[model samples]
Target chain A: MNSEIRRLTTTERRQEHCDVLVIGGGTAGSMAALTAAQNGADVLLVDKAHVRHSGALAMGMDGVNNAVIPGKATPEEYVREITIANDGIVDQRTLMQTARRGFGMIQRLESYGVKFERDEHDEYAVRQVHRRGSYVLPMPEGRDVKKVLYRALRLAKVRSTNRVMVVRLLKDGNRAAGVVGFDSRSGNLVTISAKAVILATGAAGRLGLPASGYLYGTYENPTNSGDGHSLAYHAGAELTGLECFQINPLIKDYNGPACAYVAGPFGAYTVNSEGNRFVDCDYWSGQMMAEVAEEVASGRGPVYLRLSHLPSDTISTIEGILHTTERPTRGTFHANRGHDYRTRDVEMHISEIGFCSGHSSSGVWVNEKAATTVPGLYAAGDLACVPHNYMIGAFVYGELAALSAIEHGRSSSIVDPDESQVEAAIDAIYPPLSNPDGLPQPQVEYKLRRFVNDYVAPPKSATKMEIALEHFERTKTEIARLGARSPHELMRCAEVSVIRDCAEMATRASLFRTESRWGLYHQRSDFPDRDNARWFCHSILRKDSAGAMEMSTRPVAPYVVPVEGFEFPTTAAGDGEPDAA
Target chain B: MPSVLSRTEVPVSIDADLCVTGCRLCVDMCPLDSLAIDPETSKAYMYVDECWYCGPCAARCPVGAVSVNMPLLLR
Candidate 1:
């Protein structure tokens, strides 16, 4: 039977051994691998795409969204801001790790030739994007961030294996032994044995279908197909606040951020069709998004990012930064549409919902040290649930996870690869290749994400969520019937299964929370009120021993910095702003 | 259903005249893994309709052979 399973797909097999294995080569995975290798651990960083361009930072970032710089902002103050922004459901200890160490991480990146904007005084040019504090630090020359990280990874001698989509973590009695995956180009089975594994595969960005009707058009890099979320859940790691989805205001059809954080300080704000500012702040809080959603659904339906009010020179400056970094196609997107920042307000709409800890509190639950609930398994980056931890936070937690993983690797010996688990993983990955005449991957994935957008996008109701669960249940069989014409398509087919799993997890967590919280993020239409006494705790989702998804709650940890006198504004402030939909 | 040849302009295009036949930089830089080397032409081309139009293919091109146009839908 084992031989038959091995022969199911006639592809090459390869094995590797490392002291620490990082399963992504993006922003956090790059840092984690560099840190581990610099600390003298044998590290192997794996990515589904080339390490030079992978994950959210594939095109490099535009700015540091949460930089806790010295003299400008204290870690405690930053923590309070995020706690309020995330609606007070955060582990301060975990957030403090990012807040306290993010500055050092930024300096570390600077050491790698990455640049950050500084004023004439040479102090970091931090801008105000949050409701209370200034945390946004611009990176005008950030387009080469990935190139710099890639160069740093090479210098550190971290062995990077690109184009391998790691599907499962090999477990030895709750300790992560290694990972099993297949090559995206060649369909080769890859098993890496390691003392510890760090999961940095980013957000479940591909869960919801984009309004453009394009399967690959996603807010985060489409490569981040909920692989980490599904892998973590399957490995019994608790995922926190899956109900707290990441919904941003983005360029309609384009599906990328209107990037108010970059332009907000430059005087760009979201406005209704009547050219009135409905929301006070452009910072991406659930409350702000709730306001945006409200105005869009109301008589003031279509909103625009009001950039026309800014001076042409100022718009040019904003364009110089925006068009060059992150999604550089923003310039082309505008140019092709005959829209100019000087003449027209860029049309804006609510983005398709996704599970991301970089923006919201939805990810594999990790402690301050970046260790998951399961030992020997660590998580960082957007997938690690350090609430609202952006790029700098990813670097901070990556460093923390690397340090902890190195220590853990030293104390533990490599466990033998679990044969049964490897066989099962191979069996799961090769089905699509064998059934080449089965349903195409794109069609199956499109339907699954469409279900995500239809039944689970937001303004959640119990009945809608139940129906979503039913569709997801049926999609499981559909996933089994998926076909792939090549190894590349096989990788996408495997990703569809991952997306389906995430959709179900999101639905289950939304149902379990039972009360409306986090503004539009987990807003329950049936239960429209915030029930702090009953639902203020963190909702955790994990796979049970019986292989069924289970949910439970963990009390919000005692605050390190006490927040007082701040009224919990459950709904959007009324200024003709509609309720959270 | 029978397949029919459909014509549509893709977001990414390679100037094969300028492209180095052996270099796969643009193909490897695509996050969606959309670009691939054509065996017949020995030049990189967009193999799938799954482009994010993110421009890494063009950005990473050493010879400036790659151009990522805005997809028609967005255009």
Candidate 2:
């Protein structure tokens, strides 16, 4: 109940310099900052919240989704599976980097006190969640992930500024020079100059409104409102697979992961209202989601995770792991509704659409070295276009980005940011503050996201997407009228702008790839078919010099691992048999 | 135009008797920046209803006085 609103007349300005600048303190940014600092580089890590607990892994993850073990799976096998999973719209070299370097990254993470599930024989207890490979490794007690990363950062002597929301990147002749943002705790403008910059801000989770009509309730952390996507696009970086939205099967009203990945290894599977299994694979891919969506739309209107038949001990074990890990409030949420996994079926629903290259293939494009098209600028984790990167992929690519940044810092000199660009960033950020009596930030964001759900969510058509683009254009003016009562409100206002940018990107990308591909994701009502001859390659988009989003295509690079006449499977279900742990 | 003030129960609650006067563990760790120290009592309370209910506030509490419930809508 903060009723008082203050109109500030002037704001303080601060400046700093560093060898490497890491934008986010999430899974990838933390590793990037840690690795860069450990390699004897002066690093500055900035976050909108405290680095100790922020981003997607703020409460820690239940398991690593794409772990590649030496004996269990080889790099080439992993690459082929990901290529097929992403429907051959992948940069095989980038996936190979994570496939080859992930085990070492896992060992490095273990050195930093992160625990992994290993068997009595001291082998990684990897489970099969993919169609062809076994990669899902559970971290049953992995709740202190951020705390451990924060401690490692402290030991490395890396400088960090918490509660600062970065909104733009500073470029020195097509190379990333630094970043510009403002402190959320105090309304001071912050400008930091660096020789190399890495963008690790998490996915655009807040693009579509949740079914519960709640703004903060999103599958990804609500704090990650597509800031990195917007920042990279504004910096003139090429983004790929934006049409491949991140839509998962989550709990209905709670909007959390229904968590088949965790329960699947424990013998739980998704079934239709008739108590019959619909999809054979519980692995999260666009094809799996399409099958689930079809089942929900058919005679079997609602889907439920059938755990009622499992033994009592098995139920308790699944509950223990699910309750303590990511989205721990899930237990209380189910209890409040008088639903128990032992008796009643846990309800499942499709999640709101989002832009996550970690789960799908939509993000700022990066190479095997984790470098973006812009020099001195790098990206990794959920925001980078390494399809289905998951947590371990984020870790592996974070290390790669850090190694590249360290090498870049050794060769490059700090370039001075133009004062005019810094002033423009300041000018864009403070408009909401001056309009203290105008529209509230939350209302503006809610309406924009609602439009995303109406016009840009699945079953996309060119007509509806063009309408969405029109609404997003008008939303730009609506965002300008947002009012901020405090620095916290100002931060929310900035996120509204970022979310708007992501919505526009999603629409434009969906409209550009005039075909039904990636299953439920980017399924155009008009196109209705996947045209491999034309729309087979990666759909890339970026902000052109004219300040407009321009679309183009790049032929999928010569496949490092041969995939012969690959046509993405419309449905991955087979025999309806669940995989055992 | 006058700003309207409405009351709603927030997720994160701190017991004033058990909360340390100068401690800000919960306030500092909130990802959404929802919690703040009440100037009148020097006790931390959720100032906004925008809580993600991710439980960092409850986990980071030094005195074990903070508890986070699901936001009302989700609950």
Candidate 3:
């Protein structure tokens, strides 16, 4: 962790060069850097925080959500399940890449001393939590995931820097030429000129205001801030599936995941106040979210994950696993309220809306090679458009992006860094530092996110979204006035801009679809029906030449292995009775 | 614009005795940079209210110099 933090210059600013630059060193960026380095490209992996402990996988994950081990589950089955889970909005090629290469990634991580649960015969312990295939591979000791990746990065000789928060990409014509950002600790400016760039900056988790009213309280790591999503949009890269919001069933106020995946296989499940299951599956899909939201909104006002039914020993196991990985502080949050699994029910509420393809499909669009619409630019992990491609999928897509960049850079010459563009980027990052009495970032962000909640948080409406767009446009002006007394505050100010971009993208994409899909994720109250014949295409958004967001659609590529009888939870009870509309 | 320091106790705490003089392991690894080295004491301290309580500071502290409590608001 200490070794990952280094400074290149003593003065105010510095410049560096690399064949490939991987931004945001988390689960995916680490792999991208390693793959690029192993492929003989000089790579620079820069992160806003320490690479050893940053992004969604910073504290490490509890399990691999989509692991396709050879005998446990085949690639075909894995792809089909994800396609169905996402309601067929996915591009099969990239998802197939994740399914096929998932085992290799697991083996690679295992070689690095990262352990996954194994059966008595030494096979991967894959659990069934999704609608179809058995994919969840538990990692009880997975807190060491980042440590393993850090060691791998060092072994592969990937050059790196930390605490430098990249604000935007330096464009060479329409292609990404480099990156520019400021150090979050010292405010020292940074510029990295590269032949190609890979964005693993993670989800737009902070786009929606949490019910808790705390700005940092979000389902994803707070540092994500939609950096990749904003960067890609501004660089003119087309982003797809923005309408498919990532809404999870979380602990009411704390807002962390209720973690049905870890508890479901152990016999605990999500239930309304009546202590009856509403949805047939525990998979965190928009359909499941819709059902839960419906039940909670009705007379079954509150929800709880019923864990008291389990045996004492089984409860102990659940407690041990839930308390240690990912959101490790959940135990304390529970104990503070005197809620124990043995006697009391842990309260459940749906998570605030955000963009995350690792859970649902809303992110920067990319192909099977992990390349975005813009050449020399790539995306992976939750920010990439591979639906339901969780942790292992992040690693695979990272490898795909790195290899793609290496191949592309080896053939093409590095774009000459534009001096004016570099100056403009540096100029954009310093306004907060220059002001002494401007509006504080948190207030600005809080107001911005409140608009997101009112306008975009599910059960959507055309009139309300139009109103959301108006508020977002006004917030963009407020973001310019955002000031900071410290580098940390400046990071928030920069993040506000990113959040604004995501909010606009989400609203426009939601309105463009004109019909509800993915259940609560894109539930348009006005357009209350799924129009597969007309609205089946992926909703795409990007910044046009005139600097306005343009919304369009891209056809979902033909399924490689034909999909049939796929289902997302509908507006019906588990007993197949027609639920209240 | 003028600014006033708002007071709030951060959840993460660093044990001064266990921390080494030139070491900023916990400080560097904090995603929020909420943990910092006190220049005079040369020991890490929770300097800001931005901590997410993600626990990397405590987890990566080689000598186990850091510990985190749930934030005041959440608790």
Candidate 4:
């Protein structure tokens, strides 16, 4: 099937070739591009927005949550902690890579001018955020992380293109041949052929509607409309753990991160509405989330972070970090509502549900080397399946993907696909431009996400998910009729399809598991209990060879370090192969 | 059905005088693709209220033309 000697022709299209193509310019995308270029590969890094400030780190992070710095934490300790945090549903091999390589990734960032908080000894002032380990390294100056990464991208000589929104991949049989996309600025179709493609687009963060009724305001950057997640799924890659939704405790209405990790260092922890510490620890886990969900839904309604008791100086320090990085608009959001951390407590609520591995494990499945099941296509960062792999994990895996892609690009004999295949994608993007009077992408997106909140957002019931599948099924047709008036809206229209696919996967994975796990994330109201007998395996969703959504259970690979106190499915002990559920 | 002309309280404010023609850095940098240059005036403006208030448009503008405010829903 490597027969591609035909002359390619196209209209209103730009064609380019690179040894490796990194399809996003966010944290992982930039790092992957930098590594590929440093290894002396001709790389193309294209993003829907500018590389300088895009993806989840558009304004940079509040801190590195998974920094396994020496003298602070060991890789084994981190693996064990994450194994426990994920409720024992982790592929330790992939997470072990992130844990082991994260320190180097942090130093690389530091060398490029991204600073991390240090103690008097200038040792990485790692603090305890997880229940069992100290891995949260605060970067009070973390928003500049994007600037440092952008500089690294420039120094490494990666050719960067901003404002290009990729819609789909051009597959040459099983391997990814190239991409089919358009420029966001002028709405022109641009195609790129490459030996290897790495999708570093962040999570499907916009899957659920925010309670505030504002669609753009979300916990993760709204730009991460699950473009990479859906792109991989449609390209026939197995997506894992989507049932484990990325639910965060956030400041209500504003829908920004409450930033418990940032606030915890300064004596702020989550409390019930009556201002009592309901949970023993502030580290985010399914158990912690379950506590918050139960407490919030209880007579102790509207759980919050009680920071009013902190001294004024301490409160100001917390405010400084909270206001300037990782959803920096929290200051303005609180001010307009007449709330103060020194006086009134910050109201906290569970955020909109999403499919992300950054907070929880749910993404396109990749191995320890960051290779997806599809040949020549790799994934990194939150969109890849490395459980609870925070910022450092994203960077490490990004480098891994770039290194692996460079190696693959050297050996792969793939070439450009036929022009008709490229033209078909180009031809598809134009229909919305032609159908100016069709449904607005926003209206369709809003409705789809609302359906997610209603049926798929957990404390899930079988009936609700079944109804959700019905709505998602109808959304598949409604998304086709989505119209756009501008290139920007066209980008959104294209993203709507990705969001729809993620919604379907989320629903299917949620339904197939049939057991309540991850607190309110995948808690089936009807099931009400963890069924370790049959549902302990990772929920893997894939589009079958016949182009139908199929859900199966992938055996959670046996841990390198023996895990205690948690029960594994009986099937995992005897059978290593996945059981079709 | 007919569409009604509507306007929103845009969170991002760009100085038309400082927004030099061909300087669409803010327009290009907006992650949501919320900001676009007015073709006739050649100055970038927030065409939609979909701004997440992540503030990259203001950060990357070479001419310091973009000023961002938190949207009213949150602000």
Model 2 clashing residue pairs (backbone): none
Model 3 spans > 4 angstroms off = A1-11, A565-581, B1-5, B15-21, B62-65
Rank the models by DockQ, top first.
2, 1, 4, 3
TM-score of chain B of 2: 0.90
Considering chain A alone, report the TM-score of candidate 1 relative to the true chain A. 0.96
After superposing candidate 4, which stretches have Cα over 4 Å from the reference? A1-9, A573-581, B15-23, B39-42, B60-65
| Per-residue lDDT over A339-413 for candidate 1, one digit per residue giving the tens place of the 0 to 100 score | 898989888888888999999989999888998988899999999998899899889888989999999988887
TM-score of chain B of each: 0.89, 0.90, 0.87, 0.88
Q: What is the lDDT of residue A48 in candidate 1?
A: 93
Judged by DockQ cut-offs, the docking class of candidate 2 is: medium
Question: What digit string (tens of lDDT, one per residue) describes model 2 on residues A1-581?
Answer: 12222222123577889999999999999999999998888999999989999989988888988889999999999999999888888889899999999999889989989999998999999999889899999987788787789899999988999999998899887888998898888877788999999999999999999888778888999998999999999998889899999999988888677778888877888889998998988888889999989988898869998889899999999999888888778887888889899899888889899999889999998988999888899999999999999888898888899999989888788877788888778777877776779788877988999999999998999889889999999998898778887788999999999999999999999999988998998789999998887776787899887999999887777677988678534432232111120
Every model's TM-score: 0.95, 0.95, 0.94, 0.95
Off by over 4 Å in 1: A1-11, A565-581, B1-9
Q: Per-residue lDDT for A51 in model 1?
A: 90
Which candidate achieves the best lDDT against the true structure? 2
**Between the candidate structures 2 and 4, which one is better when assessed by lDDT?**
2
True contacts kept of each: 0.77, 0.77, 0.65, 0.75
Model 4 chain A poorest ten-residue lDDT run: A1-10
**Candidate 4 lDDT by residue in tens digits, B9-75:** 8788999999889887787677787887898998899878888888778777888888877777667
Better of 3 and 4 by lDDT: 3
